[model samples]
Target: MQNHHMITPCLWFDDQAEAAAQFYTSVFRNSKILNISRYGEAGQEIHGKPAGTVMTVSFELNGQPFTALNGGPTFKFNEAISFQIFCDTQEEVDDYWQKLSAGGDETAQQCGWLKDQYGVSWQIIPRILIELLNHSDAATAQRVTTAMLQMKKIDIDELKQVAASQ
Candidate 1:
């Protein structure tokens, strides 16, 4: 069986790939562990495993498939790629921002971009970012951006204050 349009986001971990995958699947609703498979032979000692360690694990997050691979310490999650959460309200933003920022790094950018404890980046953006960017002028948008550059979690009121400034 296969879903033609299902494309899973693969994650790489030093040795905690399975643990992290389970954690994520547990945190999100409409989610569960789909499958877990160890390496065949190619990824044996290369991954500090017996050649059949956890080569890959498929999980679901909010019904989305995500694969985690224990590929050793060759690569680590950096700030390059980040997941953006489009939230409908400030409360939603606060909830996710707080949860993701637990033991994570807050970049204090114009929007909501932070690195979680596992070094995985997340953007707790409001769904209004697109609307705000569309409706406002560059000058006003610049002000909002300026305000946002000062803090994290993106307080809607604070962003409005910047947008309203002359």
Candidate 2:
């Protein structure tokens, strides 16, 4: 059978699959929950989840497919893996940064990286940062890189200022 989504990233949650899916869909535009699967009695012994409880949530965020699984507490999210949000303006960067880092670990934020309340690592980056860093001039790129390293939420204006100062 042909599948709509070929490779979906699965997020392992400790009984928070549905809640997480709801939150994610709310954050991005053109996103919604597509389907849900509940635990069954057949897997009670190994899974330990009660029948009818949410086992998995299939959802989309800005057209990207993802699955949140109530896989117990066997795994947790870390910074090793992260999702990048490329924004065209500073407003977009600020909006995502504020929403995603509302109750996140403050200490973990650096270089446009933040850990959300669910411990999901996200990078809120502006498109200009990429262009600046990949500029033909090496010194300008270094300056912008230094500025970015000192910031938690990337500032498009600051990056622009740094790039032009040289």
Candidate 3:
């Protein structure tokens, strides 16, 4: 086990901490559930969860440490925060897009962003996108950006084509 960073992103869930942790671990390589802390009688009145129920689940996704808390329905996930997965190839982008959006809200999907079944937002991006978007010529970058804006799951070939066209 490796020592993780002091600051880890904590995900708030409504009794789905364990399930979301399992799902995320299965999706990413080199990921696993590190620990689980259960609720206790000490804070039963305030938490309202069963004593043995999960309170927090510490996990890792692709070496990034994350904590999921079963904090009840007091809060909900929104687009304000999202996890971005950068892929080196189109295949990698497609694979991650398909897997992450499987049970997600299709309507919320645009420009490679989607809200998963757990309501967590994710962005599946290609590395080439950054290069294209940062090209020396502003026109080329603008073309790529325009193509991306019209897409749900980004198409690397389309971006390449737009960049190549006059």
In order, candidate lDDTs are 0.75, 0.92, 0.92
Please, what is the TM-score per model? 0.84, 0.97, 0.97
Clashing pairs in 1: 44-51
Q: What pairs collide in candidate 2?
A: none
Tens-digit lDDT string for candidate 1 (18-54): 8888777665668888788887766355456776567
Residue 112, candidate 1: alpha-carbon lDDT: 80
What's the TM for model 1? 0.84
Candidates in descending TM-score order:
2, 3, 1
Give the C-alpha lDDT of model 2.
0.92
RMSD of each: 2.5, 1.2, 1.2
Error of 3 at 22 (Å): 0.3
The digit string of per-residue lDDT tens for model 2 on 28-93 reads 999999999999999699999999999999999998999999999999999999999999988899
